[model samples]
Target: MIDAGALTRCRHRVHLDAAFPEQLAAAPEDPGVRQRQDAATAKREGIRRTLTEHAPDRWVQIDREQSARRRAEDTLAACAAGADRIWGAVLPLDRDVGRKAHCEILIRDTDRGGYIPVIVVNHKVTDPGRGAVTSGMFEWEPREDLARKPRGQARDQMRVAQVYRMLEQHGFASPALVAGAIGYGSDVIFVHDLTAILEDYDERFVDRLAIARGESATVPSKIGECRSCPWWPGCEEQLTQTHDVSLVASGSRADLLREAGCRTIDDLAAWDQEPIEDWPHGAFEDAVVTAKAWLAGAPLVRRYSQIRVTRADIEVDVDMESYQEHGAYLWGTLLNADGISVYRPFVSWDPLPTPDEARSFAEFWTWLMAEREAAALSGKTFAAYCYSRAAEDKWLLDSARRFVGTPGIPTEDEIREFIDSPQWVDIYQAVSDQFICPAGKGLKKIAPVAGFRWRDADASGEASMSWYREAVGYDGEPDLSQRERLLQYNEDDVIATKVLREWMSDRAESEIPLATDL
Candidate 1:
């Protein structure tokens, strides 16, 4: 059956899953997905408990342990009995349309004389400002008394729409085109106006349905989602053998290049003509450079004659580790000054989403500021480096805001000032500006080229996420060894950034070939 998730998944994946199930390769185990599923289950249970506490006698819960058919039967019986709420309701599969849905909660709308779907998801659904209204924790109907903040979760909306369509088919949908979702770590029910989203949802569902029915082409293109896709190995093999343009260029760039008769890396490398329509000047040139570099098996090539890298007398490489959306639990810093280097880790052993997070973040911020002050006083220039400023800056501002009253936490303005200053160096941006990396520009991709390696062979942000869960005892008893492994992994990350910066400054110009030379 075409479940809600399938509607938003890779279209090629939907086709393969439906039409070529035997050809589907197994994707690597992603512990993060399991972690999120467990967390979502906990949140769903929490929401149900809260609802039960308020209106214990009004709710009917469908047993998830029961068979799907039995659960669907129970759900319809609950509706027939005019139950106020049905938790974990599995709708009967619609064979005609090949659609099925497992709703988190279905609340009976008394005024509309039918049920409305409520989806519980593992991410925030609101932006913390009033733009929408929601139901009371005890009530199902949207409350006029409350003005709640709301944000769009497209996936959640589409899921809700699918359930709504199922309800409509069975004559159980609420007349009002509305639904609600409970987001991660939130009590407020975020409501959605499904009417506005249904048209778009229907269009996507139709397209996916066509693909699943084997009525549409299922050409696989390398994309961000392919990293976790089960068909990746097969698709990568096909793309490599076919010399697909998408191997070197991505998204619209690949489409544009193909339209310009550059269908493969070889084609792109040879075509030195005018820029493709809608391409920014020099972007196509860079794409061609990427093609040539890819064909040459070069991980990276210089974009210009000289590579400029920022350095300081007192330089600090920083990396922060966070547990999902809980909090930044560890701030790993490598301080270098006067020919001496030391690694310092400000970490909270406490489980994330705890008050101790403030302590760890505050300590790191205080130490960093102290070092900056000391450097300035000694007439030494100072700079703090991170691979990418986006991830680090997000948490920096978020931490400052979340733990505002906590000791040692910087003000939002202070954090902003530091990030905006020249003293804050984003090494990733520097690499991107001076080089064209056909492989990628992530620290893990570029660091090895500079001869920097992680202590843990399997060191990766994804693997680190699983490590953090074990270190903090998310699954069961905490494994303290995982904590050390995580520290070493994080330490290696900060050092990788340091080594990358040094290599760009010292060796890149001579070792790397300029794009013009290619």
Candidate 2:
């Protein structure tokens, strides 16, 4: 059946899920997906309990342990009885469209005399603005009384829309055409105008339904979603064998290039015509260069005649470890000065979403600033490096803002000034400007070229995410061994940046071929 995810999932995946269910079942689910699903399930249950406790007499909860058919019967009965709240409600499937919805909650809309679907999701649904918010425990309506940022959780809105469709089929949809979502760990509900969402939602739903039903042909294209897709291996193999343009170009850009007659890597590399009007300036050229690099079997191509990286007498490589979106829990640093290198980690062992994180971050900032001050006192140039500026900069600013009055925590302006200064260098940006990484620009992908290897064979950001759960005792007793492993992994990451910087400085020009020459 077409679920909410089908609305947002890769088109190819939707086809595979429906037409080749057996293959999908054979393929192992991504560990991260499994973990997230489990967490979301727990969070949903917690929300149900919270709502029930607040208004036990008004809430009607269907037993999820029952079959889907039976759950739908009970849910409908509750709605017909004018129940104020219904949890774990499976709406009657829309056979015409083959759509179904397992709503987290259906709150009775007194004005509309029908139920409004509310989805409980495991991630933050709101950013930090005035949003249409309501209390989850009470009957909800769109209101701006609560402080909430309306982060457009498209999936959540689509999920509600899916349920709305099913509700319409059952003749129990709210006339107001609105829905709500409660983010995990939050007590407030963010409402959505179904009218505003249904236009785009309906268009995509029909398209997805056709693909799922085999009425439309589905072609695989590499996308950001492929990282977590079960069909990625087969799709990747097919794309590789066919020398698809997506191998060099990204997302829909590959499709656009294909439509523009550059259907494959060779075609793109050989194109000598005027730049495609659809492409941004220089992007098409970059794609052509990348295609050439790929054909030459060069993972990276130097963009210039000579490459240079910022170097200092006192160099610090920094890498921060965050536990999902909860908070940054670990700040790993590699300090090199006066012919000596030291690895230091400021870690908070406490479970994340805790105040202790502020303490750890504050300490790390204080220490780093002190080191920079010491370098100035010694009249030595100092520079701080991080592989990618995005993550580090995010936490630096976020931590400062989150823990405003906390001792030793730098102000957001101070953090911004540091990142904006020449003293703070993003090695990833340096790599991007100096080289074209056809494969990828991730540290794991490029560090090997520079002779830098992680001590742990399984070292990866994805692997670290799982290890973090164990280290922090998310399920049970904390695994101290995993904690040590994370520290080692973090240290290795910082060291890799240092190694990459040194390699770019001393060996890159002599070792790597330039793009123009290629």
Candidate 3:
């Protein structure tokens, strides 16, 4: 029996193909995966408890429904108490087969004489109001910033429609969707009508389910979704054996190549010698280069033969560690010169904006500006490098704006000019432009390939956040060891960026590409 959750994941063909098999198989335990799952479960239960407390006298818990008939009867009885809340109400899709949906919350409308199903979500709502308007059911999600506008796609309406179908099948009154988002110490609810979306889903998703059921062949797609998938290892091995073109190309490029009769990397690599008939004229050369890079296991494939290097005598690699709730807490910098390396860390012990945090931010900016000025005075070029510039750039801009009157805070104009200047480099963009990453594009994934390793085996952004929480005395007394470990992790990140920069410099100078290069 396909539940609403299972049907939702059916949007991806690869996920759909692996779902049933994975359910029946005994999969190996992944700590990261388990941690995430546990966190989600706890969040859901916490929200459920909160909602239950809000309408304690009115709520009727109906999670114990044994069959579809029993669920329908229980749900109907619960709805009799108009304007009251029903928690864990089971709604039936088919009585004979006993297919049911255990809704998170249901609100009975006295005036409207119907039930409004509320789907509880622990994660941030990517879309808030649109899903209900499109699919006719409400979505509940966390809201970090209430001022930010809700965004969503029309395709997301299908999930709401599925829930609406169950309500209709169970002979329950369907009304507007109510989305409850709990975050930032409050619950934000959004309401919308899903009539049109439900009709569209009936016309579209019903037939797709039939096709999905009959699908015997696995549809392999190399995408971000594959990272946490249980079937990834087996699927990757199969794709590698077949030299699947998806290993080197994805989305429309993969489709175009496959349509042009270049189904695999082997085919694409040989295409340049004898170009395929009706092949895309523009992408032909690039496709061949990418294919060759994949075949040769090259680190990078340069589109242009000539490499552009920014000459600098003084180089600094920067990495920032921050919690979403808190502002940037740690600014790690790795300074490099001829036969000299130094690690500098500017840190804030406070979780939120206090005098200490303000001082830390001020110190970091002052030190950075001083170093840049010193380089200029000495007639040497100074450049600051980071793995991905978005977070670092955003934090700098935000801190400048938030602490405008604070001493040592650079002006917004100065910050913008500095970021836009050639003195600042984003190594991720540089590497991506020059190389085709077959393994993955993350710093942790790519850095190890260049012989850069962290002292801590399990160092990650999530792990650092967890350690920071402990260091800040979230659970108990602040552990100095945890704080030290976090600093070390941040130091390793900056060093990794430095290593990547040096590796790029050497490759550009020698013009000798790595084995993965095209």
Instruction: Find the candidate with the highest TM-score and give its number.
Output: 2
Model 1: per-residue lDDT, tens digit, 116-206? 8988887888765566777666676576423446676778988999999998988899999998888876566778888898999899988
Task: TM-score for candidate 1, please give it.
Answer: 0.94
- What are the models' TM-scores? 0.94, 0.95, 0.77
Full candidate order by lDDT, most accurate first: 2, 1, 3
Winner of 1 and 2 under TM-score: 2
The sequence of per-residue lDDT tens digits that candidate 3 reaches over residues 1-518 is: 44544444423553455356665366666555554555556556776777677657777776653665676578777765463777666765564432346666676655555676665554444343333322222233323443444444343355455656676665565554432323322245433346545666665555455545664344675655566666678768888889988777765567777777878999878775655445542445666776787777765555555555454899988899876534788899988888598999999887554557667888998998889999999999899989889999989988888788888888889899999999999998887776556555789977876679999997987677667767887557888899999999999999998877777666553643543344
- Steric collisions counted per model: 0, 0, 9
Model 3 earns a TM-score of 0.77
Q: For model 1, which pairs clash?
A: none
Pairs of residues clashing in candidate 3: 136-194, 141-181, 297-516, 298-515, 298-516, 298-517, 299-516, 299-517, 300-435
CA displacement after TM-score superposition, residue 464 of candidate 2 (Å): 1.8
Per-prediction CA RMSD (Å): 2.4, 2.1, 5.5
lDDT of candidate 2 vs native?
0.87
Displacement of residue 347 (Cα, Å) in model 3 is 3.4
- For candidate 1, give the lDDT: 0.86
How far residue 239's Cα lies from its native spot in candidate 1, in Å, is 0.2
